[model samples]
Target: MESEAAIFAGAVFSLFGGGLLVWTATCVHNHRPVAHGVRPVPSATLAGVVAVLALAIGTWCFGRL
Candidate 1:
């Protein structure tokens, strides 16, 4: 039961993280500035990539359990 919950949570996180990664990439490609230049493209891209990676790891761990 706990494992199932963890898997479900992981799935949700992974889905959102993946979407964020795609959105960030699209923003960077289209040269769209964010937050009035408060958040630079490269920084946002890197953060998104990291978030996706973290979520992937979490998903894998949940699956393994």
Candidate 2:
């Protein structure tokens, strides 16, 4: 049987991962076009940070299981 701690950790990972995905999706700015036609910095940074955090959290949580 799985331990309570593992189950809790897994739940937290799932929640955070899903939340991060949703947050990243909304970080896009559709109002303006870039001068250089490149992706804006803020949205990219937001996605990167969220993705890294989610990965780190998931790895840590899975390791505990």
Candidate 3:
């Protein structure tokens, strides 16, 4: 049972970390273009990516807990 818990905890941490990193990188990507005199990212793309990542992390954490 403890091992199971550890595995679950590790999975949750991985999911959360992965999601956060992806989201942060995407946000940076979306912003960087404008800073360099290019068009800003499409709002829909950013929102969708963020939403998917958040959902994935939430589901993973819930399963672990």
Candidate 4:
């Protein structure tokens, strides 16, 4: 597997990003919904930022292949 490190990093980044995005979605949903009960850790905006960064890094890693 050429660029194995890249592949691994890409996979990790993509998964991390995907997870963050899911968490953010949940956070947003919970925040709004019918009414606000409690806020989750890491605001949606912050999680979104990290998620985008991770996804971008993953894309870059995959591009190396």
Candidate 5:
């Protein structure tokens, strides 16, 4: 069985990534080239990349379970 921490991390990361993805979509739909308020520097491309990485890490964690 996976530890409690792994489960927690997986859930958190997955949710965060999903949220990021949604935010990105909203920005794109609005015709904005950049997303703001998530990080120190706002960027559309970076946001998308980070979202994917986060989701990937979350999936990896879940796979461990």
Candidate 6:
């Protein structure tokens, strides 16, 4: 149904937004000052963790539909 599709789309967008928020926060928290300027680089481990968490959340959301 259209409602179900809308809910699913909302869930996906929310999950993506949450992931981006976390990633941005991590980057800000781990920002490093370089010779040129401050560079915000999220660590690989942090990125991986975020990715896994996002995947889990997405799976759970879709499973509920």
TM per prediction? 0.66, 0.48, 0.48, 0.77, 0.80, 0.48
Per-residue lDDT of 1-65 in model 1, one digit per residue for the tens?
A: 88887887787778777777777777778877633556676677676777678678767857876
lDDT of 3 at 19: 62
Give the better candidate number (1 or 6) by lDDT.
1
* Over 4 Å off, model 5: 36-42
- Can you write out model 4's per-residue Cα lDDT over 1-65, one digit (the tens) per residue? 77999999999999999988887787677664322343444455666888999999999999999
lDDT of 6 by residue, 24-56 (tens): 566556663211343334344455456667666
The residue pairs that clash in candidate 5, if any, are none
Estimate the lDDT of model 3: 0.58
Q: Which runs of model 3 end up more than 4 angstroms from their true locations?
A: 32-65
Report the lDDT tens digits of candidate 5 across residue range 1-65.
Answer: 45677889999999999999898888778876553455423577788889999999999988887
CA lDDT of 52 in candidate 6? 65
lDDT string for model 3 (5-27, tens) is 75676576566656655665676
| Candidate 5 lDDT for residue 48 | 84
Residue 58 local lDDT, model 1: 69
The lDDT values for all models are: 0.73, 0.64, 0.58, 0.80, 0.82, 0.59
- Report the lDDT of model 6 for residue 65: 70
Best by lDDT: 5
Give residue 57's error in model 4 in angstroms. 0.3
Q: Please give the distance, in angstroms, between residue 62's alpha carbon in candidate 2 and its true position after superposition.
A: 2.1
**lDDT for model 5, on a 0 to 1 scale?**
0.82
